[model samples]
Target: MRRSTGHPRVRWSRRGAAGLVVLLALALLAGCAAGPSQRPPVAVRGELLPAAPPPPAAQAPADPDRLPEAEPLRSGPPFADCTDDVLAGLAAAGTPVPEGRTLRIGCGRLTVPADRNRPDLGPARLGLTKVTAPGAPADLPALVVLGDTGVDGSARAAARLAAQLPDPVLQRYQVIGMDRRGTGEDLLDCAPADARAALLDAGPERGDEAAMSALLERSRSIVQDCYLLLGGQLTSFKAAGSADDVEALRTTLGLARLNLIGVGDGADAAAGWVAGHPGAVGRVVLDGPGDPTLDEPARTEAVTAAAESAFDAFAGACATGPDCPLGPDPRASVRRLVDRLSGTALPVGDGDSLTAGATLRAVRTLLSQPSRWPELQTALAQADAGDGAGLARLLAPLGGPQGRFDAALATRCNDSRVRATPGEAAARAADWDERFPLFGVAAAQDLVACGPWPSGGQVAPATPQGSALPPVLVLGTAQDPRAPQSGAERTAEQLGNGRLVRWEGAGTGAYPRTPCVNAVVGRALLEGRAPAEPVVCPP
Candidate 1:
């Protein structure tokens, strides 16, 4: 080494190559004597070069607990003019227009694939109604309202919601209602009239194998007949597909994000949409949301337990009054009435009998609406008097949509993947009767109807663990007869970003009913800030 320079430049010659190899061997020996970390970086020139900075520390992934903030939704293209068609449809269905200050109303239908998974199923139409108030801004965002599956007519329900909602809410947003596919017609018409009548017989008495067998057979026949009649069309009716329909509606309406209020079964549809499309959601309120994640048996048990509890609450409330038809002990009165009906079914005109099944169905329906508790009392009083007309009147078809029962059955079956066999259904019914007593038998027996339905299809709508989705408001009614508070609790847990608000009351839903619930919902939707802690409302 001439002067032992820290950096040396070698000449491109045979001698330089030989010298370079010798120098590298010497350096390797020197490095082995010391440690690799102690070695300094080789200099490019006459100066020592700085070592490259160590790779940046690996970062932990984003927090899954924090919900994404809601963004302002932008308005899209103007909707088509279907005012006349929608008004005519409502009139034809005998649904009265909602009473409110409605300055303008727009209606349109979006034709979506019957089965998005199967193109051959052709197209199905979804009805839409947009209600705007007199003082509302034209550019206000849209609040889509989805009612209970099968029974609620979207346009009519939206109108009613528009009329009932607080003026501040309406002034800030226009309300839009959507009619799900497979509506407007009775799909259950494929079953024979007599078979349908036979299925309504819930009066074989508990432990009567013969009567249970008869009901099961009838259910099997009706379900199979409807499937055979509708064929692939029946498969087209799915809550998951309905979720996709909401996205189509959002795109059609030209909204950057959707603010939705889903009531009853409609909550499942809304949750499905939120799960599949998190970024597209603005604000969501699930009122008495049904938990589709539960299997058939679990769901039946939950509803039965809730219904039983609801009946207890209803009876307790009724017993406080002198005019209560259920007497001092309403529960006891109801049990006696049920026992009497089981022995001798009361005739309620139209060849329909107020059997145990019909009685339970009527009671279950009324339990969800406290406003109709008086009607329940009257029905019970009538049944106690050997006249089934009152109970039968309560079973009369709901007004909003036609073919409501048929639609409800179809959707219930289609949404569920579990189909109990005749034996399983009977066993479940017996267990339910023993446990729940009043409502369990009918609920479990109803499972037989879905037994004949096609299987291997998607069960309900998929609820994803959406970490980046905006906060979801899930309202649970403590004594809800249909959806139940437990279901709402489960739903809120399932939605990673869900905030649960519990209403300690007897009803199907909480919104537009309790001031506390309305305040929570209003704050969530209007202010875009959902409560971090769980909220509870008093009746």
Candidate 2:
């Protein structure tokens, strides 16, 4: 249930750049230098771990049973109909409604029943952004980009990509970005002014059960209060309901064929969209993949292993540094630090001190990006010197600059259905500590926090069937800390016409930055061609 840290916006120093080059060289040698005769295809085996049991059957379904089926909504002339209200809203939002253009972009609000099954009830105004391509064709291709963490950013990225394509490509495509149900501009603002203060004051004390329960109760109360203040306009939020929304948008947009691009948990929505829509979809792109079907134990195991591997790579690099930032033995240094932070409380400046919770937060942040390993090395060194300021700086962002942790919790809790019985949760943490000896314990606790969430969504039906859709280029970084490189390989293998493109260094694929990678991806998307062999980036 850990959220990925935002992509870092910092530039690499010359030394860091050189290090990256060397890392990439090593990765290329590890992955590609072997001849075809020497390299054999790997077959992954083992059944997925069993999923956690569904919430007690007594709880209401996260979403209603059925949604309204309506004619695909359209804008005017070039479109089927033009609604003035939709037009007005666009103008109000400063979105241009182009005139006499072959393609028309429209903005509108759709009122969906808070619960899909109850259409007779009042509706919530969910914002929609639509782009219509112009061409005489019976069935046009459409894609819905689901935002990974932020709706606004996703919409912008979708629009940017849509604009960059050729006129013919544009004419044959339609892209829409839905604000989902409860986030972005659609977030319910009914919580009283003091709700934030109340939640902050309810922080858990020493991981005590009583204190944690109090915190959960306070969070529930805040959400309930907000729901009531909104006049029941918004109910509980879940990914399944969001999937239904995608279907509704597809129908409303009038596209005969659909495609979906899902990033992070948004990938779950894409899978569900395909599952629910069936033959209606032409293709799918699951960036930063996470299987919606993975049960709690499997996901916990997968992420834990990925984290350990990434950390080990970082430790290896640190050990090679002349100064030996942490110590002569970087691996042992990490283990000792983790052990020290687990139990003892360290004094902090201004009367604040490092606790187990703070330590977990620091580890989570560091594990999110392998590229930041050097920074983590520096932070750990500072902590070893008896100043916890570096660690605190790393942990501060989890709550966000405004200190709102609820948003992160809400998104993660609604996305996955993993939980631990209080006893099991505690035991799992201890087990993780014994197994990983560095990262497993904190990850287990984070996964456990989602167990008691009231709204748990359905797992998307697993359809390992590959799409006959055009060849889609897939990219993976060997050292990505959050989304492991193996995930990219799995996704590519699952894709009917996918080609795995491997990059050796850290972070996610360098699509927006690396010209070489982008050129290859552009070829795949624009010309329906994939490289014959993996593109090896030189150091």
Clashes of 1: 0
Per-model TM values vs. the true structure: 0.78, 0.58
> What are the runs in model 2 whose C-alpha is more than 4 Å off?
1-115, 118-147, 150-236, 245-260, 278-284, 317-354, 370-377, 383-394, 400-404, 416-418, 464-520, 530-539
Give the per-residue lDDT of model 1 (tens digit) for 459-501: 3434554435767898999888877787788778777778999
The TM-score obtained by model 2 is 0.58
Number of clashing pairs per prediction, in order: 0, 2
Question: Listing every candidate in turn, what is its Cα RMSD in Å to the true structure after a full C-alpha superposition?
Answer: 25.1, 17.8
Clashing pairs in 1: none
Name the best candidate (by lDDT). Answer: 1
How would you encode candidate 2's per-residue C-alpha lDDT over 208-310 as one tens digit per residue? 4444444445555555543333322233355676676666555554544445666545555565665545445534455555534356766666766766776
Q: After superposition, how far is residue 350 of candidate 2 from its true place, in Å?
A: 7.2
